[model samples]
Target: MQKKGHRDSYTTNNQKGTVAITDDTVKLPKIGHIKAKFPAKINGLIKSATVSKDPTGKYFVSLLVETIVEPLPKTHSNIGIDLGLTDFIVLSDGSKVANPKFLSKLQHKLAREQKILAKRRAVAKADQRKLSDSRNYQKQKVKVAKVYEKITNIRKDFLHKLSFNLIKNHDVIAIEDLNVKGMVKNKKLAKAISDSSWSTFTTMLNYKAEWYGKKLIKVDRWYPSSKTCSGCGHLLTKAELPLQVRSWDCPSCQQKHDRDINASINILNEGLKLATIKTVGTTGLA
Candidate 1:
């Protein structure tokens, strides 16, 4: 079977290497004669199959069969993921996925260009700031825009691959639906908040789970997915845990906690209910 592009992957297997062409005559294992429509043709050996759409406005299919499962093995190990400003996701499995510090990394160039833009704006020109209409300002704007875009893309790619890896190795996944929009209201953290892309990471995880036949369990928007203890099931009073305290010891269990790991544990537990109910869990949403 020939491989297809990442965005439009397809594979065909069987002695015929193709299914007979016809409307409402698709071949699948066990259920040999099934139904389909345009762009859905018989391809490859019969197997459990499904078709679906994507956010980008496209259709695709996935087939499960006995031939091969590729290197993507299901490890059945689970991890709780904590969302934060100091870090992106802290896994309950004790693996820390560091937040790339995107804004911090790109801050120098951003500040420089922004300063230039500010200087241009301060000129107070009636015709518009000289810098606003100037060729150099426009050039800087493009440069800055591209940098912003590049950083955003880098974050997205990294998050998607990470989520995919998690789905491949684990039986279940847990995460928080952060109050991102509300948190961004803080003037000081707004830029860093925008760069974090916590929501985007969750989006990738949501769909990847479904595609891979894994579980994406979401705790709740209001639940403190982070401030609870996974080991002792003890919750710190809201004032007990402060933003800067990245590490602590659970009072009840006496287990030392890395903020992310603890949050992850809470998420894992909360996600269990979701794993059992399709209507409850939204671990991954494309």
Candidate 2:
């Protein structure tokens, strides 16, 4: 089967003449040495390699290497992060990370590219041209694809940096178990939720936490982190806490709280509780 404008990829085993990696280039099974960029030194035995061409006409090689997972030095710091659309992440330590909003920033450019692509497709259709034979349409399609690819790369870079920072500095990283799929069903916040890419960020945190021997704790989604007071442990009713209220004062303790930061603190406390229990018995969210 073939797609009109889709990526093509293939994987090769590490058998003889299958795959070989050098300082700057990689030798594929039959495709001799190709110029490549290796961002980091490959530190392990190469197991396999997969090569693929993206819709934007860029090629990439992903090497599967087997290496010893070395843990990072302990920093003895624990942090809780609250992910949100307003700000990307709010830490329990009262630090806020602004959302990059990469897709939103490039929306106008993407719209222009999409319009051009649509016009080219229309012209090709009017001429009854096959998509594969329509040079203009294909070219415009690649332009549109490149715009999307750029946004994806920017988002991924941001996530990697943020995850690395947290994993490297913190011994325990606590975050809420977000119901991203359900959150996106809200039409008003759907775009923002999708743009934040909370799931991808959490996945990065998970794997990196493991690699660095850090604890990644996911508190239960149903926990009343936002409604509970971090200082007084007072639980506010759902009716009392609304989305519009970004800051609130605890009735019991009279302590003012930034909504996200308070929730992050609560998450951190709960995660620590879980961690304490895990040391003695089975590990669980509760």
lDDT of 1: 0.69
Task: Give per-model CA RMSD.
Answer: 12.2, 2.3
Error of 1 at 32 (Å): 41
Query: Per-residue CA lDDT of candidate 1, range 117-142, in tens?
Result: 56555554544655546766566556
Clashes in predicted model 2:
0
For all candidates, the clash counts are 6, 0
- The lowest-lDDT stretch of 10 consecutive residues in candidate 1 is 1-10
State which candidate has the highest TM-score: 2
TM-score of each: 0.63, 0.96
Among all candidates shown, the one with the greatest lDDT: 2
Candidate 2 wrongly placed segments (more than 4 Å): 1-4, 282-286
lDDT of each: 0.69, 0.91
Q: In candidate 2, what are the lDDT values of residues 1-286, reduced to their tens digit?
A: 1353567887888886478878888988878899999989888888999888899888999999989988999999999888888899999999999999989999999999999988888888899998779998888889989899999999999999999999999999999999999999999999999999999999999999999899999999999999999998999998999899999999999999999999999999999998887876754433
Q: What local lDDT does model 2 show for residue 32?
A: 84
